[model samples]
Target chain A: MLRIEGLTAEVDGKPILKGIDLEVPAGEVHAIMGPNGSGKSTLSYVLAGREGYEVTGGSATLNGVDLLGMEPEERAAAGVFLAFQYPVELPGVGNANFLRTALNAIRRGKGESELDAMQFLKLARARLKELQMSEDMLKRGVNVGFSGGEKKRNEVLQMALLRPSLAILDETDSGLDIDALKIVADGVNALRAPDFSALVITHYQRLLDYIVPDKVHVLMQGRIVQTGGPELAKQLEASGYASVQAAA
Target chain B: MNTVVHSGAEGFLHRFEGLRARLPGQRLAWVQALREAAAEQFRVAGFPTRRVEAWKYTDLRPVSDAAFDEALTILGDGDTLPAPRGERRAVFVDGRFREELSQIEGASFAIGSLAEELPRLEGRLGALARPAEESLVALNTMLFEDGLLVTVPTGVAGGVLELCSLASRSERPSAFHPRHLIRLESGASLTIVEEASGPEDTRYLHNPVFEIELAEGAVLTHARIQREGVKGFQLGTVYARIEAGATYDNFTLNAGARLVRNEIHAVLAGPKSACHMNGAQLLRAGQHADTTTVLDHAAPDCASRQTYKTVLQGKSRGVFQGKIHVHQVAQRTDGYQMNQALLLSPDAEIDSKPQLEIYADDVKCSHGATVGALDADQLFYLRARGIPEAKARSILVEAFLQEAIEGVTDETARAALESAVAGWWEKEAA
Candidate 1:
């Protein structure tokens, strides 16, 4: 389970996430829907331990392990994964080489024997096939010259390969089309198990139609104002975030 | 040569006066005149300082301050040399050829020590170089004891050849100036991998000068790797002249030495000739490396391309100066140059200058330079993917150098460069 209490964060001396209290139990997928300045992305970045995001007062944990006190790679080893809205492009870095290195690093952290190149290639090719991505991606530089849809699909492919217990999708469906959205949703749904949980943060209700969340929370002004079942996402779609803003 | 006296360069001039009769090719009148003219130039100019335009970024105070004695005899037979990178090897110890340590049994082309081949190298030795113009070249021309001399016959494809310069461990500070002469006849081709290395704690100088001549329809690929000791200094220069339909491809990697300067002067003197120069400089704390090149387009329809990358860590410094000159009669010339630097620490420094002087109206020349630290977003992305911080930094550094290494076409040379880069990362991370 992933839990957060009184999460207050600032960027460059300005508050962005204030008093954010949320929790997602195991075997559940929750969605956080908000407007442009609702600080949705900031929440995910803070949870991932990115630099420059100063946490004034916050307590976040996964399975009773403190998340705020560890490095980004340590948080990843503790089963925290953040799918970036803008995937960084790494020129001259081959995708196959990068994925293998990441996987081997995590495995080493878990005291697991590392996989050789051929074995890692087999696993990566299988994951690419499931995501419907071309094997040519393994040959080129990571995210270099990739289209918008291709970048999104690459993120999903990474999430599948890493297989983190707690995944955070921050505005992943922004530039994706319906078909691409379905592929991403299937990738997430395929990892649904008793030990898996996810926090799907998005803006529109169209993505929720494909991957129905167990719970939906209305976030406004860096705070969660209301919480309900999946029907809250549909209700917000009919009545925009303005209604939630007024109620808060 | 007369016992001319100069202030800053008197140390070398005094040595040249004492070693004139014992130097190689002393029996030839042309060689004597060449040495005398070079000595005269060195006597007048001395070692270059910061005031000079070409030596603005690099300072040679460390070289001039210390008195460097000459290595009189060869190292003992117990000394080990670096492994050869090609089939044929020509080894040089303390700038003198070591025939027993070399392995050039069945070489198709002509390869021998310049000291032994001085009779055959009458006018070709000093034909390409301008010792009267450059101080370092003049210093090398006056004091060079021995070097490699290679010549390929017409239409023959001379295979891979390794020229290794190893500086022996000495108790006192010493210096060696090796002058190499390489020529390829028309329609001939050859690949040369030049490796220079020394003991980890030796205080010495390995100043080499190369004079290359490429005839019509000929090609030469030269790759140089400099890994001098921590207390050593290296100041090397190369002069190449490309004729019609010839190509001069050169790549250099600077990863060692307390201070180093590698200079190249390439002149495209014939129509349709090309010159491709690429290099990477990797420096750590207390290290300084410089790569300077001057490309001259003297004929019409010629092309030149240059790309250089420098990665600095700790308190190290890096410098790159590239100039492309197009003559008035050189119409339809194409020239491009780019230099990029990545500073790994706040204390690291880089000085990059890209210059272009084009007199032709139909020429196309472009130059660019970029200096930056590692990208934060890229670093975070890699860390978030579970790669350790040190590993991620190494990965990014390797990626930045890969672009420059790709321009090297020869497989053997490229492999040698890749291994050197890997070794650098290992030492850095440790």
Candidate 2:
């Protein structure tokens, strides 16, 4: 459901994501494994339409619609969700309010009726329950003073609430513990459907163990050098990115 | 200290000479003398200039050139006091109390116009609010039309008092000075909401002076929301003297008027009293709102706090000046002041001054101020959640002001203020 052909991007006049090609079909979970400065996060940010990341020469599409042409909110409305590695701390914006606004915004964009406060609270409570999150976290400021695990969990919770068609989890397992990883993986696994797809960007292979990917892509120097089955992650863990870099 | 007289005040001096004959309480000898003395004070001091520290951020030259005379027309036909049903209300049109619209007949405490109760209010009229160094206060004292008077009986808990001020229908811009008096007897209590508003697109001046005195063990909660006409000018001052075991809590929301200033002077006169001054200023597009307060801890064991927040956008300006003074005998006093502003535009400006003068040996006093823009990461995060850029901005601005708005203790008052802020944001966004 997601396609990137020759996805070249840059930040601060310096090339980050040089020509890259990748695709994730419907109902499949794809894991992108790379070391630091490999442009994995850059690709995720470009997909999410964040500022300061200029897509120089390539085209990325979700559901065959141009992603880079839309603003951040428009991209969100078009079902592009990004689970940030470090969720921003909003001092006065409550998590529950933020979730409701986002849900209603997307729903409105799709010409659907917005949910009332009662309905929103009920829906948010149920989602939090499924994600093993407490209601108190939703009452407080979004990601303010939250632990690393809580921030990641909140990101996953947001993904669960939005239920995007193409979800991009950028380094979701970076600061997570074993339990948090399992919870986050469960949150993603529950959203699996014939129309749902995910691109999981991770440094380690541990996250893929819980949410097994149908395909594995090795990204080195702004290019996806290799694509193989899920067992490719096992081999990469056994060895290291040094071999992959030399091969690329 | 040398005083710098402004030409703006000199013009006002000429305007007051013709308006003095029609001032209220003309029959009362003390009241007339009080007005004359205040006029003399205005002549001597003139308007405070930029050379003076207090009037540095604000200038009265623009207001001086406006041709706003006395409000000649009262509440006309089809006019209504916007007070909610069942709430105690004392409505005023052009600084004159509207007895027909006012619903203070059956309130537990006494409420009437200053003109009707001048005999009873003579002793306390100019007592609490003696306009000495301030030219605006002096001008208000000299040219006041008619104001409300509320007196809570001793040992009785009073209900919510709604003191509302609405501008009248006038072709040319009009000006009104209202002198309100509030007295709470020993062991008395009261909560008051003062709202100042006018017809949209009208140019008027609402200069009101409030004198509040809380006796021993009394409690007073005052919330003033100033939503004058968008093109109007509002300059108001409040003087409160809190007694032993008394508590005076005041909260103001400055959201309207092209040029607005709300000044407050609170004195803790008895031991163990407390006073809190908290407010929020929301301005957009050439609006200028200022809030200045002075807290005096004159007795031992008194506590005072001042917290203010301002949000400015589109070339707007905001000013906050607060001072806390602890007397030598005021040992164990606790005084704190904080001012913060959020600038939503590059052209927006905020000036804050916080001062503390402590003579007591054992006292805790601290002050701080901050001026900054909205966090970029916060805006991006909100926008990423599908909220539009404008919606995200208003949410953060409201949140920034909520820190000070939350200081209002009463629930009904808090809700009223919150809804008012929401309404202002809606209009601003639109």
Candidate 3:
């Protein structure tokens, strides 16, 4: 579960998220739809504890733990994952080594035994099989020289590996094709559980068709103006955000 | 009153004057004359100052004012030596070869202490070294007591040889100049893994000069792993002459020493000859490391490549100067050089200079330099994966150096270099 009350945030002295309140209870998926510069990405970044996005007057929490007071790594250890829109390219870091180190780091934070190299390789191979990815992806550098769809798939691969309780997909569907979008949606849908929740920030409603959301929130001008069921996404697909802006 | 400006070479000149009669190869007239000439040159030049273009970035105040002991105190035989990196090894304690500790007895090629093989090394010794032009070489030529001498005959494979130089712990700061000579005959191949280290708290000076010669169709791989004491000073110089169809591959890792410099000059003397100089330096907290390289394309169709990376943390400083020169007759010469540095802390500093002087218009030569801090986005990406900030930084640092480390072709040598870098990271994390 996640909660944000009066989440007023700014970037470089300019306000982005004015006053907002939103919550996603356990076992629910929420889709936040908005036009450009509507604070959709800003809300995601602020919740993920990224630098340069100052939460001026608001509080965000996960599992009743204050997320605003923790470092990014601490937040991650507290079961939060942010799938970047544009995945960073680590030129010399191998994908397997990066994943193993991250897994061990989170394990250590959770007071669990770390996995050995052999064990990690076995687990990673199985996950790659489920995702229908090549073993060669493990040998190559993380996100280096990968195509846009492959990058999205890599993000999903990371999400699958970390298995965070609360996942924030910040426009992960932007550069993905139809196939990759379906694979990504499947990857998310596969993790559906009583304790798993996700906040999907998207511009279009195409991705929602693959992984239907329990609730739809139309965020406009740093505020959530409307909330509805899964049918709201189909309505937005027919009528663009311009009508929603006028209504808002 | 007229005051004399200290050239910083006065103390070494004085030491040379006193030890000239007792130095190695003193009985040979040519060797004596060579030492005297080098001493005279060193006396005139003293130590290179910041005013000199070649020494512009590195200041020698720490080395000059150290006031090292006048004579080397040869430690006792019971001194503990670090483990050998390979089967055939040559150990040197404070610039003097420890034959008892060495294991090169059954080597097919000629391998022994330079002082013991002086009569056979008459014409070959100092052939590739330019003591007259380089002050550090002059210092080494004048005062070198004992060093490794390896010669592989024509068409022979010398395999891997380990050269370990361990500094003795002395209360008084001491200085040693070691002169290592390695020659590979035509069609011969050899690889040398050289390591220099000392106690973490010992304050000493390790000034070594290496002369390498590769004949036609020969291949020579040299990897220098320097992990000197944190309070020590290391200034190493290497001169290699690669002949036609030969290759000189050299990689150096500067992971320790309060002040250190690894300088290399490689000349491609024949068509199709190749040289690759790659290195990485890790400096932290009051440490200073410099890597300077000069690649000379003297013959047509020769190729040279160089890549140097430096990572600075705390208040450390790093410097890299690389130059590639192509002669008029060296048509179709291919030369490439890249130098990069990553500053871990705001106080860390890096100075990089890359130069190319080409006389042949038909040659392909390029050089580039980059200095930057860790990318914020990259750091956040790592930290966001649950890795602590310190661990994330070290991972990035290691990754940055992995590219240059891959250039080392020798497996054993590359492993040594990799472990040295890993050790540095472990110490930093601790």
| Winning model by DockQ | 1
Candidate 3 regions with alpha-carbon error over 4 angstroms: B1-5, B74-80
Q: Estimate each model's TM-score.
A: 0.98, 0.95, 0.97
DockQ metric for all predictions:
0.88, 0.68, 0.81
TM-score of candidate 1 chain A against the true chain A: 0.98
Ten contiguous residues with the weakest lDDT in model 2 chain B: B77-86
Q: Candidate 1 chain B — worst ten consecutive residues by lDDT sum?
A: B72-81
Q: Which residue ranges in model 1 land beyond 4 Å of their true spot?
A: B1-5, B73-80
RMSD of 3: 1.9
Q: Which digits, one per residue and each the tens of the lDDT, describe model 3 over residues A96-200?
A: 999999989988888889999999999889888888889999999999999999998898898898888899999989988998899999999998899999999
lDDT of 1: 0.92
- DockQ pick, better of 1 and 3: 1
On lDDT, who's better, 1 or 2? 1
Give the C-alpha miss distance for residue B370 in model 2, angstroms: 2.1
Scored by TM against the true chain B, the candidates give 0.97, 0.94, 0.96
Candidate 2 local lDDT, B1-430, one digit each (tens): 3364556566556767886666667778998898888888887777676777889999876787676766776556644555562368899988999888788877888889987778667778888886787778898888887898888999988868788889876778888888999999999998888788887667888889999999999999898888888888999999999999999999999989999989999999999999989999988888999898988999999888788999888999999989888889999998889999988799999998887888889998888999899887778777787888888888888888877888888876787788889989888768
Better of 2 and 3 by lDDT: 3
